[model samples]
Target: MRQDAGNRVPDRLTSLLLGGALLLLPALALAVSPEPKTFRDWMAGCDNRKSCAALSLPPLVADTTAYLRLERPAGPDSAASLILRLSGDWKTPPATVELKLDGTPFPAAGKAMPVTANDNIATLTFQPADTAALIDAARKATKLSIAAPGLLAEISLSGAVAALLWIDEQQSRLNTPSALIRKGSAGAAPAAPALPVITARPASGTLSEKGGKALAAALRKHIKQRDPDLCGDDASPAVADEAWPLDGKRSLVALTCSLGVYNASNAFWIVEGNAVTTAKPVNFPQNDGGATNMLTNGEFEPKTGRISYFAKGRGIGDCGVAGGYAWTGSSFVLTELSMMGECRGIGSDDWITLFRSEVKTAR
Candidate 1:
């Protein structure tokens, strides 16, 4: 009887092991399948020196797209590198992993590699032969996959052919970088124009009419392409649409095309010392309603020098938020974002102070 009990233990363990192996069969089959319809756009480009690269996202379970870049050597002598820039909470455990490509067995595509990490970025280096194989598989295969123990990344090869061709042209400089690659001259691509320097406003005194006009002109010149898209063509016509005063004798200038209630866009510039720079809301709400949910109207408190704005809640009539900010020498820090949701009922409202430095001093 004791011998039978010992044999039963071994049989139970074998059954459990078999069940686990059966569960992994489907996942292994999926890893080799050719159908991959989840990947979005594939983008490839090169820098001025003809160093080319390609970036794309694998099939993601979430709505966001995290890019993984494969870069080739700039010239004939440079080394190859693969970069993965991660965001939010997506990451694999820090360990050495073997990457199998195109359904190949482990070490068939490449050896076991340790991924180096820097903050939110992970990098891996490769030889030229492996790099060429990667590009080739990207161009020809229907589905390119890289599998590790806990991570399985799959990218659709729909536009990879065009992307690889673009990379080739970028490296050879056959034609100026454009939408497509074609045979052309062999000279260097022309240098791109430099971005203008934005000056800061004076700290001691308010901007005079001439200073304000100069600063506004610089702002318009720098944001010409962006301004038209955001606020339309008539934004900041002749002069700035609105201007307000802030601490340190500075001014806040606003540019807008639509003054009506809905679908209106506005850009802001802050004048300090003798320069004007773009400024964003210190605390912008991240909600399903988008940018319109942020605090729109802003005003400076007379006695406290604190900046305040109107913050709307998430839904149509969920609540109203009163947001406040204080310039702390370095940045406009959020002081408070208080909400009052009970419109016609007797429910209690909620008030939360994000930063209390200015509030503590005021008290």
Candidate 2:
């Protein structure tokens, strides 16, 4: 009898193993199938340069506000190449522009450098060594002031640019203190408006599977031309029943969709109207922890106008990236995707799948 009982143990174990394998089959299929890449892949294909060309510099306006504009080409790297363009009337360049970073004066001995002044334009190029000092100075200045022999121009820094500069400078101070410096402000550039927040009625549309597939195909073609790594062999399609609300008015189509890198899943809702519209993703930090992606949940106010979304990528420990988006008339526009934290041992290649999508109607 004991021998018989012992034999049953093996049978039980075998059955359990078989059942487990059966359960894993669907997941394995999902992992193996091809999927659609992200809008980033599409944008990367175009001009990923984060220079003045990419920036929609506000229309030239005549205002007393000091203008300090920085330009740099965008790339998938740590530091951004900064081209500081200052415009204003200075009888003569200041003896020495004292730049403060995060409230402390940036170290000049090994960090800060003087910008080249041509005509009334003073240009400074920031290198790796000067990255930190530049970031620090930007952060410390609650009120950015340009002090010269008889020149004093003060302008308040705000919006995404300010946040970006502050973050860049802070990181520099912490990581590479020898890189970066604060150069003097440009004479009267128009103050940047606060970043726009999305607020709209929940959008609903009926997108035919055929139509959705066609749209996806067109977008994929456009995206892959620039980023060959996108979708790759794992491109497939999956749809959702309802649109994922970006805000009260605008919502992304999929609540949980397949993007080659990992499963993009989240719950979304709207925030305050006007000045501030925000949404948070629910399923963040994917199961394996390799899928570190966050997207802002909101859309533009005018339904037919522009749409925007924010995305952050982090996974595999210290490696992370941050950026956002704005929709062009036809497709979405990709903004800067800055590498933050330690981006080592990080795996790329994320994809997306849309199975079912339809526009909702006002009831």
What are the lDDT scores of the predictions, listed in order? Answer: 0.40, 0.30
lDDT of 2 by residue, 180-246 (tens): 2323332222222223232223334344555434443443344356555432323443243133223
Whole-model lDDT for model 1 versus the true structure?
Answer: 0.40
User: Model 2: what TM-score?
Assistant: 0.27
Q: List the residue pairs that clash in candidate 1.
A: 200-275, 201-272, 201-273, 201-274, 201-275, 202-272, 202-273, 202-274
Give model 1 RMSD, 1 decimal.
21.5
All candidates: CA RMSD (Å) = 21.5, 22.3
Expressed as tens digits, the lDDT of each residue in 1-363 for candidate 1 is 001111110111001111112100011111111111112345454432344555553332422223445655344334446544322233644355455545674346456767765553344555556655565565545655554454555556567667656665545544533222343555544332222222222123355667556665665555566555544465335353444555464665555433333122245556554454444422222322122212244554434545565423222222233455554434444454433322211011222111122253332
Q: Which regions of candidate 2 are displaced past 4 Å?
A: 1-66, 70-74, 91-96, 101-104, 108-113, 136-141, 160-363
Worst 10 residues of 2 by lDDT: 1-10
